[model samples]
Target chain A: IIGMMAMTLSSVAADHLPSWNEGATKRAIIEFVENVTEEGSPGFVPPSERIAVFDNDGTLWSEAPLPFQAAFAFDEVKRRVPTEPALAADPMVKAMLDGDIGKLLEGKHHDGLMRILALTHAGMTTDEFDRRVNQWAESASHPRFKRPYLELTYQPMQELLDYLRSHQFECFIVSGGGADFMRVWSERVYEIPPQNVVGSTAQVRYEMRDGKPVLIKTLDQLFVDDKEGKPVGIHQFIGRRPIACFGNSDGDQAMLEYTTIGNPHPSFGLIVHHTDAEREYAYDEKPPASGKLTTALEAAAARGWTVVDMKRDWNQIWSNPDAASN
Target chain B: IIGMMAMTLSSVAADHLPSWNEGATKRAIIEFVENVTEEGSPGFVPPSERIAVFDNDGTLWSEAPLPFQAAFAFDEVKRRVPTEPALAADPMVKAMLDGDIGKLLEGKHHDGLMRILALTHAGMTTDEFDRRVNQWAESASHPRFKRPYLELTYQPMQELLDYLRSHQFECFIVSGGGADFMRVWSERVYEIPPQNVVGSTAQVRYEMRDGKPVLIKTLDQLFVDDKEGKPVGIHQFIGRRPIACFGNSDGDQAMLEYTTIGNPHPSFGLIVHHTDAEREYAYDEKPPASGKLTTALEAAAARGWTVVDMKRDWNQIWSNPDAASN
Candidate 1:
């Protein structure tokens, strides 16, 4: 019955997440799943207890010098700047437009980078923002892979999402990026729709425009989903504590902390340590743009989080390498 | 194995929802359970497909005349106004303080009521707001029932949350009330933590005070989780469209619409039509406070949503009515 359930789930997951290669990641997923679903196993977790949370940028896909969504925003600012000279003169905005990845990363702290993101990304209608994201995803290619940024996803994680869902796990993308930004593409890339994606958001206002009620973006700051905010976001948005969590950076520490705090059954927490420089860029503790993972390693070790060495644990990088290569 | 999984899931559900009486509601719940979990049945749904959304107010508990949270806010305003004469002179504030429930409802639409709520509820720190909720829930009583309003829950729906969860359904409370307000007591009342409760919200700001980061409430209107907002809220918060939806009024129509719109499977959509005036107040499509089930009734029939007459469907009302008499 467990195997059958797993098969059905994996099949449905494959419909959306077609990137996971079949190997250790898949095997680990199936084994943990069978143990949880199989009757009378000590690891047997009831369906209500099957809450799973995932990080959007790295654990589910790839975040190297910067998160893909950030890259998309930079490119968008560049594309739209012919009409706006002030933004063109702005150093960070100019760097973003020029694809000068090095200058974009210079001397900026986490808070500074987030402020830049807020300025560039906020105040657009949700529809306008989504169209922009879709357009950029279709056209923009990664600097290293030379493939559309969407093609830079990790295949094994996609399989894991399917595998977990098959066994009654409720999966979510809890990231430091904008919730609306990630949501626009999550359904296509991860099969996790707009509703399951939780991240940073700018303030939105409800107003009647020409007799229609619409939500409009405001030039106000809301919570950024990172580090301390992850747990708070999980608590505020989900209302239920998660049982399993996946993350890559220190930004995800609080989420891991909160997930491990679940009582009754043991909670599972995993970290994706970038160790595969060949297939994907490898770094830890501090990346060039955001130093979100360094402070989390000790806490993760203390909490017994499973750290996956990307080079060793994953045999395949993403699901559609052939498609991406072309 | 299916029976055992059902039993285990039911047991966990019973722990959180101890109020559910053991009869038809239980049987209906079990039947739905079996159909969804039994292999090869037309109703058999995989865990990934098993998304459930619940209505927070009357469907989950009692919220007639005014929602319980509104009562709490009224009580708080009254308690604080001994020193503030301006509030005493303000008709709306005075009406709330004087326990003039009728006045609060007078000439007020949903948006107006929400605006009043924002004025009454905002300008406090998150922790302070949580404390107010906790204190009020502990002491407040239902005027009609004379029992603490927290105890006035629908026993069967509590079981349904557990039952669906056991069968691998992800259950969430989609309501028009304040999200933070419902979140405070939902865990204690429904055994659902704050993360799964999605409702109306005022804008919140993150600030560093004395080297500590805290989220403070602003009187700015955010999303309202009612009517059309129900589907939007579910989409924004849960990301996954629900396969099963339970609601009570026109407010729940969109949720039921969204739920029934999921991919074809043995999906279930139920409406709790209040009809047991003696046991629980019965009114449909026309009550001043909690009325508005008309469109939902028509939509339910058209969409195949199961309209559950509370008088006919429920064997008992609250979990410990006999205990209450003592």
Candidate 2:
């Protein structure tokens, strides 16, 4: 009896995903990892080819209340308006200052919101922009969680990153967020380097400023890495099709299709359904912020993609800061 | 006396750059590597921050008689013309077939040759293009060297790559060549992976063809990553300033400047001055094909960038296939 009890305790201690509940979603992740990692298995993928991509906002962290980037942009507009009074002249800036998200996202392509982003995100040197992002990341907090915004990254997903890395998988963040914004804190928060973050990019021109080289960020050519652009960004930056993809919204539909459809290697696609309204805001078609999820969620079952009910599958959402386990 | 001789032999064997002669250029490279890697040194850089970028084409391998990509493109035209004779009607195609090199490079931007590239390089699925590039790489040989074009990679530079990598520096190829073209053989030839090769890119559209995901290449949004574009590409792809830069032409000048000028980290910039007409093609203002060096060459002395005169700096041009050293 004692021996059996000892074995059970040891097995539980060995669990890589302690935050994940014992369910179909967890089992599927484990099964796929094993299938591809087993050397002689027909589904085996080499270490060099073990690429995994994850969406940022709703997938890795709470995108509710406001997409963190939008929040940052809005805050930026408010802060800069005092110094640069002309910034208030733009309706997008006025909308942002008024916290009018619906007005910002009125157009199908979100032209108003895009213009606001260009105002807040561009027209500075790359170094200066990087410094501003770092400053924001240091002081910003989630309005609801009241914790630092960077602390809101989901615990289960962080475990998944570590779990995948244990098997030599190179995990990348392929998000709809601004690349520069994510790259600022990605290395510290996710342990994923700047080069591994694929997101929307603005044109940066090379210049010689006062006898020194500088890269000036401009709004000239903006590449929005969302929906269809996800797959395109993956190819442009990563140059290889990922075998694993994780996401939450319609934005990731194309990426999921690109990862699993007719992939030569065994592929895994997982969708993080924000199903915990109490613990974390839950919505499918409509949400408090961006990340509308109807299309991807509807297609998940037909494609054999694992759908994780955030409330049911995850025992804990955010990582415990006190946990000794690395 | 025998013991002393063995010690001398072992000292010679310990040298990483067998192809490089004892010179100021070699000494500077060794000194920079030591300064950045030594733990207690003021110039020491963390392993993760040690990024070294090199140019492709004439910098890495021979681009003589005809640049390898041009040779491949011309061959591609010849091969496809029989099946699709419409390709022959284009003036660029006619110039290529006639070996009228002057007519092909008539425009300042090489617009004629670019059109030929778009025709040969696009309108195909990316996977099909990869297969074609692989096939070409397997069969292609250098016209002057009478060896596989891949084998024409400079031994000294290859040694330099290995040497830098040994000190934990992650090396990337920032080139004017096509990213898709170089990605096919970069990993095998230069030990730089596809993600590490930043270069010119044509637009790739993602589509579902017969229920299988495919990326189609197009000539739209053609990004010619040369001169100023190199720095922009590095920022977009690598997302940080590189500490070391290597190049052989004016096209690489901006990249070199972006790497070394006022960089936070201690930096090294090098230029390979081709002066060996017997063993390798030698040109500065004029060359067999492309890679003009006038601007960069004149700037090198004032900038304190090391310039390697191929005849004086290198003992060998190409790597010996039979060498035991990695």
Candidates in order have lDDT scores of 0.71, 0.86
Instruction: List candidate 2 segments past 4 Å from native.
Output: A1-14, A322-326, B1-14, B107-109, B322-326
The local lDDT score (0 to 100) that residue A15 gets in candidate 2 is 88
Give the lowest summed-lDDT range of ten residues in model 2 chain B. B5-14
True contacts kept of 1: 0.28
What share of the reference contacts is kept in model 2? 0.70
Per-residue alpha-carbon lDDT of candidate 1 for residues B1-326, written as tens digits (9 for 90 to 100): 86686677566654544444455554455566667776765688877667788887878887787678777877777776787786667677766556666666666464435545766677777768888887887788888889888788877776677667666777778898888888877766776756678888655654556644455777664666888778667656765557788898888876776666534666678888888888988888775476478888887776777777777777778855533222
Candidate 1: deviation at residue B252, Å? Answer: 0.8
TM-score of chain B in each prediction? 0.85, 0.93
lDDT of 2 by residue, B60-125 (tens): 888887778878888788888888868878778888889887787788888878888988799999
Worst window of 10 by summed lDDT in candidate 1 chain A: A13-22
On DockQ, the candidate that comes out on top is: 2
Write the residue-wise lDDT of candidate 2 on A39-95 in tens digits.
Answer: 666798998789999999999888989889888887788878988878988888888
lDDT score for candidate 2 against the true structure:
0.86
Q: What tens-digit string does per-residue lDDT give for candidate 1 at A232-304?
A: 6775676556778899888887677767753456677788888877888778865755535776777666777
Error of 2 at A196 (Å): 0.9
